[model samples]
Target: MTAKYLVTGASGKLGQSVLRHLTETYQVAPGDIIAGSRKPETLSEWVAKGIQTRVVDFDDAASMEKAFAEAGRVLIISTDALDRPGHRLIQHKAAIAAAEKAGVQHLLYTSMPEPANSPLLFAPDHEGTEAAIKASTIPAWTILRNNWYFENVFLSASSALASGHWYSAAAGGGIAHILRDDIGRAVAAALVAPTEGKTVYTLTGTKAYSHADIAALIGAAAGKKISVVEVPLEGLVQGMVGAGLPEPLARVFASVDTMIGVGGLAKVTADYKTLTGLEPQGFEAWVDSQAAAFNALVK
Candidate 1:
């Protein structure tokens, strides 16, 4: 069994995007990369392209170990198993254990920024997963601390566009949001690049924007003026619940704003450009690109 590069959660958006960049942008051969997913059937297109597909079920440790066999490098795209508390951390640990058992040499993972001290609801999962990776026998690992995606703003942006007010719990705090695809490209580049020891990179846009700043950008792009309404954290959570989001999920989402208020996602770093030698898409550019979508929301 020859060693090859393995990417877990290959069916997901980030996973799929990373795979595309790996093959298209980085020119990694299909034969050299293995796309791992629980439902291998969904990866038919990848198979057609001559890429190897494997069943990497996090819940089934034996299956994961088998999937990791002959995998020299593995990139674990964090799963979205957030509905069940502690389940995601368990899944991540299982992947780490499987990689170690299979003698993986280099490992990589997608993580949230400042998870160790952030107030985000799912920070524990990332923090624990990072700890497990560090404790593993794998000699080298890369942790990509991805910031908030501009797409994530859509959750609240639609409502704000309609109401003419962007209600925010994060007072005067800013977030340096990068595009999801940008993060994926960076991850793909890092996976194939050489690394001597443990490395961590915080991937983010070139600048940070507060709620007011974001509202202004949206207004400029959509031809409508929008105001930023500062609300308490509890009020923000309640507002989301009123907007038909589940209470638990609403709180989890609102915690992002709370985290922002404390400067959690505010930092802008050059780590993204260092990885891919490319500038991440800026917020203004993202807004312009989504102009049609924003105008539709306004109407």
Candidate 2:
């Protein structure tokens, strides 16, 4: 009997993509995979395809244990419970405990690059989760340290297009932002083919792009010339807040520049190709593909 694979948070963007790649890209048997989501009903399509859909509430230990009990491999997608300090870590620890109690053979987790040394405010959550996973009794595990997503720039792209200015606090540092779907494809490959004990892969794009470089790419794609205006970190936060973002959320978003300015997310790696045997999407091409969307933002 082949081991069953369980993917937590299967209803999310990354999770859903992973499921698609597992069945489509890797041709994994749907019956051998379990899709775990807080609301499993959202995955009715998968359930109808002979896949097992189970509830995987991070806050509920008993349910999580039940979700993992039948799976030999488990992928724990990091939760987005950053609204409260320490809350995310608590949830991750519970998942680790549940996986151990359920006798899972291999555990995999989605983490950020260099979490322990990162300047991002949420780095601690990933760092703590990685530490907990390392301490768990699971026989084998894989840690994927994914870089920033290219889509993340869209958060400020609309406002930048509206004002014709891309403000930044990155201090000329660059970020190799990989596509979320590419990461999902790589993750699906990793989950299906278990690596040796305690392996880590840093999935990143081929090149790093500074704020100016990114602005140029977006400007060219949108047919609007956008200029980069370097500002202090505080100024960036204030601008975001002035743009109607909540102050707390603005600070959190602005921290990405803080992290970038320090070269925290500037590294490029080939690990993504190693996992999926294909190149991650390039920024220029990705921007070009989203050209219509960018044009709509300016209009």
Candidate 3:
């Protein structure tokens, strides 16, 4: 029998990749999958093709409970509420409550690397959610404690290249940056395999690199000299303000830098290889891809 899988945030990049991976590799029957979110109608094609979807807003407990009505296993992608600080715990608590009430057999979560010491100021949000999952009445749970995604670098790099500035407080600290797609694929693997109880996996790449090294790669990719500039926490906050980032975001970013400076993001291990049984893509390879994209902009 095909197992039912509910993927929260189905419209997101990670969520979409999970769905595609399951369909293409796992051959999961479309009818056995449920994509829960605020706007289920947006995923009509997936539903039409047999994947079910339902409205499940984290803020609304009743709505979330209803969404899991027919789901046996659920992957609750963390909410995007970093700016508000305490909102994540609230949202996740609702999901956990609903999942427990609905008797969902297994639950999965996407978390950050070494969440206990993550440099991201948003780590509290992730930590709180993980704690709630740990304390939940759900029969089983899995936390994919993913490291910094190579894709996360790409996000800031695109804007940095456009603005001619690469900024960070991670001066000499290195992080094992795994591809976000790999995280998605890993989640799909975990969900497909039947396992019970709550466990946390620290997902990272086979290698690690510092921000300065990353800046150098970005420079090479764009065919221009890009330098890594590390600033003090206060200076970083000021820079963010100068760049028009909101006050709350600026402070959060600055605090995250302080965490990086203290080595929160530099931890690495063989966990990625152990979990996926495959070597991850390298930083240079990611740079080459970015170079290709930048070159295309000229064409």
- In model 3, what is the error at residue 142, expressed in angstroms? 0.3
Instruction: Give the per-residue lDDT digits (tens) of candidate 2, residues 256-278.
Output: 89999998898999999898889
What is the per-residue lDDT of model 3 for residues 1-299, given as tens digits with 9 covering 90 to 100?
33388999998888988898788767888888988879888898788788988888999999878777678889999888878988887898889899999888999998876666556778877888898888888889999887777877765576566665677776677777888887777888888877786778888776678877777777777776656777777787888888899989889867766766677766776666665576778768977877877543321
Query: Model 3, which residues run further than 4 Å from truth?
Result: 1-3, 117-119, 162-164, 295-299
lDDT of 1 at 98: 89
Decide which is better by lDDT, 1 or 3: 1
Distance from true location, Cα of 79 in model 1, Å: 0.9
For candidate 1, the lDDT comes to: 0.91
When sorted by lDDT, best at the front, the candidate numbers are 2, 1, 3
Off by over 4 Å in 1: 1-3
Question: What TM-score fits each model?
Answer: 0.97, 0.97, 0.92
